[model samples]
Target: MTDVTLMDFHADWCGPCKTQDPIIEEIEEDYDEVTFEYVDVDEEPDIANEYQVRSIPTIIVKNEEGVVERFVGVTQRDTIEDALSQAGN
Candidate 1:
């Protein structure tokens, strides 16, 4: 099986990031096969820069092959779930 990871990039001060957090949390509960990582841009600038994340609430779904999908801003739960399903497959 492939190793799938969901990276959430955001800062504590970002409002949109707050909005996106719960959706990610829900996805975390549903997708046990996917690894979830939360990166605080303020604390982990290098990681954010490595991912080229220019905005808050950036959701990146990637597998061992590499990044499969990237969503900027507030993303819908279904959209993220779909991306995970595809990437996992």
Candidate 2:
């Protein structure tokens, strides 16, 4: 299994999520060491509920040890990279 995983929770109809998707995709392309995954809230409500996601564009970064960081809404690239660095990605 990958050491670090970035979970992006979003829905197709969400405007903010649409904006966030490309940013996440860009991060995925830039970070080969970090695993990136997308969860469509509309299709996977269970996963959203498990993560306690109350809004769209929720991002969860975790490693094998456990969760490193989590944020909601639009996030800065440097901030995400910092979390990945801390998580040993």
Tell me the whole-model lDDT of each prediction, alpha carbons only.
0.93, 0.88
lDDT by residue (7-46, candidate 2, tens digit) is: 9999888999888887888899998988888899899999
Instruction: Give the per-residue lDDT digits (tens) of candidate 1, residues 15-64.
Output: 99989999899889987888999999999999999999998889999998
Candidate 1 off by > 4 Å: none
Clashing pairs in 2: none
Q: Ten-residue segment with the worst summed lDDT in candidate 1?
A: 25-34
Model 2 misplaced stretches (Cα beyond 4 Å): none
lDDT leader: 1
Candidate 2 local lDDT, residue 18: 81
Pairs of residues clashing in candidate 1 = none
What is the Cα-based lDDT of residue 81 in candidate 2? 83
Best by TM-score: 1
